[model samples]
Target chain A: MLLLGKNTQKSVLIAGLAACLLAAPAQAEEIWVSNEKDDTISVIDVATMEVIRTLPTGERPRGIVFSHDYSVLYICASDSDTVQVMDPVSGEILHDLPSGEDPEQFVLHPDNRHLYIANEDDAITTVVDVVTRTVVAQIDVGIEPEGMAVSPDGKYVITTSETTNMAHWIDTQTQELVANTLVDSRPRHAEFTKNGTQLWVSAEIGGTLSVFDVETKAKEVTLEFAVKGVHPDRVQPVGFEFTEDEKTAFVALGPANHVAVVNADTYEVEEYILVGRRVWHMAFNADKSLLFTTNGVSGDVTVIDVASRKAIKTIKVGRFPWGAALRP
Target chain B: MFLRTVLALCLSASAATADVSVVIHYLRQDIEQPPVLSNLDPIPEDLGLRGAELALKENTTTGRFLGQTYTMEVTHVPPGGDLPAAARSALALTDLIVLDAPAEALLAVADLPEAANALIFNASAPDDSLRGADCRANLLHSLPSNAMRTDALAQFLVQRRWDDLALIAGTHPDDIAFADALHGSLTKFGLRLRSEKTWAFDADMRRTASQEVPLFTQDLRDHDILLIADEIHDFGRYIAYNTWDPRPVAGSEGLVPVTWSHVVEQWGAAQLQSRFDKLADRPMRSRDYAAWAAVRSIGEAVTRTGSGDTAALRTFLLGPDFELAGFKGRPMSYRNWNGQLRQPIPLVTDRALVAQAPLEGFLHQTSELDTLGQDRPESACTAF
Candidate 1:
């Protein structure tokens, strides 16, 4: 280390301050959301409930998923028929992956090696190898296959058929049909219980949540709520997330414009938070302390305190927000 | 004996051919009866029938080419009356039927065998489900879909940068659907709802009236707009002047989204409005515009095909270039994909219709009119 003059010391001090600012721990995890109508992704700092950055994506991006280790994010451009891979840190498009016709939603495998794309118009789920960005397999489901999810064990994949009112289970290993369960009309999103024993299917038209036993493929319970027609005939429960302890699950009721907070153990609705009109999808912070829901109709993302189940603040996002994911 | 036999054959043929007539059967309750019609201030009854008259006139003008004439046999069925039998009897002689009935009555008519060949034009009942899940192949809607109207208002609000909305809805069957359409539009165009308040329909009219008396107050300052969905035309009017906060009202009443307006003079609307006023002796309203579109669509079908055959007319009406030079900007035609008519609706303020969209700037990647209602991307009607 050489001794420096006053000007040099000033420059060093400035560099040190810049380093400190860069090194300081980020206070909150960011939830990345793709707005279908606006063609932009809103990066929301979970702690402050503020939009830190809005990353532009391809036309009409609907589905979104974070890469393993949360380095990259993939969004399904329904209009563009391509999966947009973006670096979440820089909010830049890293690469584009070809997908099936009219991709609406995506589900990532536990190993993070494969991605399942729900091709809405084609009514098929196309499995794409993440690293290769190649379509590996395509399995037919039903008319307008919308929401998709991967099982905890990464052994199975499930998709909701909007018009067919059914949930399809596919064996991820063989890329074959596992089971077909007839659900309520316009079944939208499917979410597995934290323990991975049960699955909850939200029916947009039927306005009821169907709980099915995954292993035995048996119908368990249909969770009914007080609000009728609050969600359009399309209960369109688009996005769902569970608390860290797996004690609670929050379901975003699409056209119903409300969030159903379900107690995981009791399987009862702990509370219904009226967030905004046409609430589509939701995301949870890394710590699972807060839940963020995108209200498509209201063009705002509502932040809910997980413990209190109360809406803390609503940050205005782009038009018609469909999907959201968190940056670890 | 041969002459007598030929005479008998001629008589039998004459008996088989009934007089060509089109029956207009509607539910008595659904139709604004004399009392309700009398109560309609600021809107005229003949204005309500302007579309019907224009359609009939167009038919009469072009009927000479087809060697057949058209006539409207207006029949009002009392509430809960048997409409199917009445419609069947009418369908035997009538080539077309225009219905302004409730959803149940429309469904009942649709279920009839005679209604198969006879085209049914729904003038009211803007419920979107009738176009979506409960869509009837035989039925074609002339009235703008609920989504269309809501989208009109939403587009207008969006262009004005009125992003925040406070929605107030009345407790009515149509009101709920209207609200849903409004909500759909708001979401589609990226508008935020600040607060939503529900008012009871059966609640004291006086109280409700006073509740909306101060319509625009400071409390409403947070909202850029107030959307009121009162199809009953009761509460929404009050909301205009009496909101506890001050905000412009949009929806059923104040700033209404309609297919045609008396104030709409642009794009040959003035000529149509004048023609309608001359023919119907009343100022044009939305219902009149829809009714006119229904008649005009049928007339255009007949004119283009130059045949009274229902199948030929239906095919022509469903085809592109079957345009109606109605009051709306540009000629209107059905989407063919869903039988939804694509027309520009007027977003009217109290003084005058403020904006119209598919406005000049708002262009659809497809047909510009496609931007007016549900885009093809999210449309549930897959069967074109």
Candidate 2:
């Protein structure tokens, strides 16, 4: 009778959590732009499409991410080699955490206690304690490790090596290399499925997106871009977000100046929305109604309607703007 | 046990006796005769020898399993020496020879009776005729042809959208040939020659100082690029700083096309440059890369084929399967049609090396690298 009661209580708790998640807002409503050359972050009021405020940060701030609670902002200062923690509401830097040399991009751990930084020139990933602002460990990676993403379960971290033409997986707990799988020439960025079953890698030189099975570590499919002579150097599949129903993945192609809408189930490119030159990172609204992309070379931000997959407006920004986050 | 030991001893003795040895006749020509260009640096006597040393190092590290060894016999021929006799002496010693001789001397050596079976490589000349109408079946060109270098420059200019060019030529015969090659490339790439001017060489200074004449008072302002052809190096540097217009310059001087540059630090260049500098006590020039690539090619051939036999090495080198790491980005191979070593060329400026052709974006239908030089469709020579 006591064992039966315990099982009933566990099921009730899971059901309550599921109900809460379903009732939560479906999208992020406001957009935050990290302007690298301007050394400021532009807060866009999504409804009115106006610049709410421009907050100043460190020199050459490039990569950015918001906390899971949407309270703190993390910005990677590439030239400074530090991740600046900021209070998003007050537009103030709360603290600074030392990262590896030339930290280009980073991802948050599932537990929200650790951050993994892809230190570009140092060829290593630096793990930092979020609350303490201390570096816990350094994981040696390949040459020019750039874009990174943590698995959904937070059990592994995947990083792309630009020159070495391989993607490496590291154990989250031990920070040891678990696998070094060759994907394509000049693999740039990686993304994992929502269920953590498969990982998709973009090859800059080979001009193809390679999909690998998470367990077997074998390539399952390759999605080739239609553009020729494009010199896919930076297939930056950055700022990935699912649709309202979690059926589609919106991928931003930096140099190709297009956004690829991919079918989440079939692993096929559904549509490509053209944007400004060197379109980089992207963000979405709270209701999943609008998507904002930072165009690096064109010095603008493209606002796209998620349903139409068409750019509705472009707002001018600072030079070489990259990274975008959203706040409700 | 005693019988087994005796059998082992006999096997070791036979293996030692079966070792193969081959000799390479390195024929070095001293073309520094009277009437030599005064401003140019004298060709170093050990240029080819330095290349041979690097090649030998690579071979010993990777080619020892082939059961063959390489040794060179250098015969330095002064100006007006008996070419046939020198070649015959080299042929008697070794079946393979690397020749650094002038056009006339090359022709004379090619006419030798013993030159038919012996393999000869031209390591110095840039003349395209040696691979064209005057092509010899026995000769292989390790140095790039004049057409190849000009094509490299022309492709770079086209990529940069500099289509209008001002042609500056010198009166020397070699300069004329260089100009012809550049003109052919410009025309082939659809670039317009806005004007052509002659920069007559001055005997007193051994330089082309004709820039003071102001030949481009009207036409110079119209051109998008300045193309200079001064083989003696006297006037090219002056042309760069004193071009009529502020437009970018390309050709022999400004944004020059070269096989290699000391300033190149991309890919595997840093290690090769350091190795060459440590050995030669000076920075490596374009000539050094060509010479180094030639010897390295031989090493690769032997290593890949697992044999140092001259005929076998030659066959493997000429085959499509052979590829050598020439410090360039891609594997270097030979153009089967003309026996030209086809490799990526570097485009350099005075303060910085700007770009490389077969630049990142340019693409060919078959191979992206084919855009850098004469494509197979335009190649005249039929022999592979």
Among these predictions, the greatest DockQ belongs to: 2
Candidate 1 local lDDT, A240-269, one digit each (tens): 676656677788876567898888778788
Candidate 1 C-alpha error for residue B217, in Å: 37
Model 2 spans with C-alpha error above 4 angstroms = A1-28, A228-241, A244-246, B1-164, B169-178, B192-201, B204-224, B230-234, B240-248, B255-369, B380-384
User: CA lDDT, every prediction?
Assistant: 0.70, 0.69
* Candidate 1 chain A weakest ten by summed lDDT: A1-10
Model 1: residue A64 alpha-carbon error in angstroms:
1.1
TM-score of each: 0.48, 0.64
Model 1 alpha-carbon drift over 4 Å, by segment:
A1-28, A228-236, B1-384
lDDT of 2 by residue, B1-384 (tens): 101000011111111122456566667667553342344656565765666565555444322323446666678877767767889888877767777777767767866888876667777778887777676766777777778789888888888788877888877777898899998888888888888887765563442454453443235638887788877665666555565466666787778888878889654365566667767877777766776677667755654455657778777777876666565655566666667777777889866778777776666775555665567777666645
Error of 2 at A290 (Å): 2.3
Query: What value does the lDDT take at residue A141 in candidate 1?
Result: 69
Candidate 1 lDDT, B88-196, residue by residue in tens? 7777777577776777788788778778767788876687877776767778888888898888888888788999888888777778989999988888889998888
Candidate 2 C-alpha error for residue B76, in Å = 19
